[model samples]
Target: MATEVYRESFERRTKTVRYLRFLEGLADTQVGPIYLGMWGALAFFSYLLCVFITAIGFGEQVGYNPIRFLRELPVLTLYPPPPSAGLRMAPLQEGGYWQLATLFLSLTLVFWTIRIWTRAVANGLRPMVPIAFSAALFLYAAIYIIHPIWVNSWNEAPPHGLRGILLWTNHFSVKYGNFYYNPFHMVSIFGLLGSTLILAMHGATILATLAYGAHREIDEIEKSDEGTHRAQLLWRWVMGFNATAYSIHQWALGFATLTAVAGAIGVLLSGPVEPDWFQWACRADIVSGLQKACVP
Candidate 1:
């Protein structure tokens, strides 16, 4: 009996290993092309889910209605249904599905980023860039999912989760003047723009090099190493960033992550926390007050 048990365990372990290997192989080929498609599908269904709920006028707790409960299975929403789906709240549907979908997407990204980071480390390449990107997504997801739970009245009025946070931003800004006036929001905006510019710079530089070296006949460039060397030299001379190209990605990742952090801080500031950002800025007259303070 002991021998039979040991044999079964060994077989199971072998099966597990094989299964993992097979999964790894599939991850390499299948995951690359289908990732964007999956994201698009999620976004589409999430929107559709919202429309379905709003059309039917169903709020949280389908409440023994089989059709309504069945509707819940299709799309995920981040907020509870508004008091009624019209006026300011018009077109908004509340449910946990959208929030759940965002979390799921973030988790998928984190997993792939970890895989890339690990492979980079094993191959003696810098892993922190990928790891940092993953960290940003994790932080963003955490802020979205955990904010509501932290608030006491998530299920009731004064929304508190992702939806609440966004609503607060919009509500406060409209009541005051502009969300951009908030310091944290300004920082987030800058970070977002800066990340985009950096990515564009990198992409354009690479494309320029490829364009410069291309030939009318494919054989002309493919058969010789000279064209490749010319392209590299041109890129170095024009961009003057050959050595630091690798570091650019790390910087971009850091900036992108900081954008998320800034947005989270901005959300906290705009909410009904200790001090309202718009109110404080307006009452304090920070700009004029600063000038007066400097008038020594």
Candidate 2:
């Protein structure tokens, strides 16, 4: 009976692999992967450019400069405020800029590459567990990495840990009018959302790939055809988990979306009013980050 069951299971798995492969063949157009890959690369490079810009001011002993400020400022005003001013101003740490630049450049670049590669693999129906793990790892890095750099750049020191996180998010919310505010900062919640979208998609793709692999593996089990059924069940569960995980990032996206809608409505409802300096900076970061996220 066991042998009979095993035979049936192997036959089913063989059939499944053939089906998936057939699906791959049918979509012979290079367009999907090409476009997805291109968009991902575009988003990644743009983020890098923005990072470079952001780092330049603070990367040096003097931090937080707008390249534009130089072209427009009087020669006397060229110097950034002291570090305590919450501006990443003059007197860069010895090799601090190099270390900071290298860290961000490597982190974003590596994650970007890993994301695109895993996407390619998932698109091709290869096993993709490594890729799924990579996406999650990147998010974990963001949660840890982003806060510290931001706190340091501030004129004032951050309180500590979760306080810092709440402070940063809250600062944006009030200063920029929402959690997703990136207007003057030019690093919009939108780009972050877009990046988040990419992250979510990558996570989904990874799970799909692994499931496909597992599907093939389980089909070869020797138990009654029950094992074959279990494989199908397992595949769905993996897929479900991916969908759920990806949804987590979508909340951030949704917040950004709401801000956009509100901004648009405000524009239609009222002409622009001059906001204060803090607002302007907040807006600049949001906008700059958004544009940079698409660089190259």
Candidate 3:
């Protein structure tokens, strides 16, 4: 019976499966793998560029040679060909370019999500999960783009403009000490981590019990239903309460949305408003020795 089911699933998947189409394409065609490889390389290089920009910016502050250090740190020696001088520009003067690039990318994602939502609505296929998650991320991006303009004036503008807002919120500024102590940042981190964990659990549970061969059989829906029931039973055994699939969807969406919203709140409350996050967090100290040690 298991062998029959497995053969039927394999045949059906070969004919109908779209989820692994991209992977299949890469495996089947030389051009597909080359394109995928190029895209992967581009993504890696983009990350390297960002890291380079960050290292240069911070290196200027600490009077360290960014190029020499980056090259040597991996191999444990400073003896290497020198990097280009263009990348050695003063941090304050050139670092804002990286921020501009990042800001533009964030705005692009927000606009892209908006486009997706609009297209879905036009097609009468409104997916609440995508829209909700996109809306939350849009707000997160908006915090970076709008907060600096809203908070700072021309004379006392943040040094790196919008990026300065993120830098300070992340406690890159000395005044804030550490953003980990900030309640909102902590909440955001937990939300992000929790959402990831919940997503993994849901995916694992569903995949483990899915009736792959019964997807096209209306009468065989009992197989799918039974699998889902088994998954829910497993979840109940583990969690002590079985949420319906719809309820689980809602919980996943809530976790994802909260992650972005909490992060935005953390950014909004940083820098000038809450310069010393540690101090703010330690304001109402209960333990006497700890209080005196942290306090002035």
Candidate 4:
């Protein structure tokens, strides 16, 4: 009985040591439970705060009925209270909840970006994920924070709703003499549409070759597999060039990143830098015969 007790105690110690070693290895990876847990908690709290604020806005605007809230969701807008509200806590209808929700959402984004960067570096991978994500984050900041500061009015920021966003976009374009003439905006459109096209091509190529036992098309491409080879040749014939399995992803990432980068630039330049995109285009000689429309 003494020997059996000693064996059980030894086994327990061994298991504990193994668990500690596992945790140590995870920590070394820079994406351990602690990092993930903090990120998850921040994200969850941000989401909940936003939901709570939206619920309150909906209840105040369209009664407490869930069905009514759902029906009116498309038209409901949560306008941020005036700057007089300041950083101090105010009533829910006076933008206190919006401020809290925005604060937590910003924190969530910062932590999420850090998590992506640290995890990528620890794994000896390129910083593409974080870089692309940061560009998107910049666009969000440009709309909600940077541009608002530049214009000296928080009201410049769009309200939190579907129709509200559309209304904001319309107001922006009308006030600034049309956004289509903005070169950065044009580039963003190209980037977004080009990324979609690239994704569809890549997905279709993989699916098309799946029937020929080319499920692992990326690996098979190097082995000169018939299905992958044919797919590549088909694209080369159609487009005069083709991306390799590895290069295709890089191409997609480039376009996707360009979309946000261009959008952020355009947003930053809208009011302070140029004020009117149509006039800028006319001055740059990109458009003609619309001088009358370009009048300020």
Give the best candidate by TM-score: 4
* Per-model TM-score on C-alpha atoms: 0.48, 0.25, 0.58, 0.80
* Candidates 1 and 2, the one with greater TM-score: 1
Candidate 4's C-alpha lDDT? 0.78
For 135-231, candidate 1 gives per-residue lDDT tens digits of: 5654454354444444422332233343455675566566434566678778888999998987886666555556554332243345445444455
Worst 10 residues of 4 by lDDT: 26-35
Candidate 3 TM-score versus the reference: 0.58
Which is the leading candidate under lDDT?
Answer: 4
lDDT for every model? Answer: 0.53, 0.43, 0.56, 0.78
TM-score between model 4 and native = 0.80
Clashes (N, CA, C under 3 Å) per candidate: 6, 38, 0, 0
Candidate 2 per-residue lDDT, tens place, 216-267, comes to 4334434444433444455468665322333544554444444344333322
Residue-wise C-alpha lDDT for candidate 4, range 218-287, written one tens digit per residue: 4565676467787888899999988887799999999998999898899889988999888899888778
| Residue lDDT tens for model 3, 23-68 | 6745632121122233344445555564565555555544597676
Clashes counted in candidate 2 amount to 38
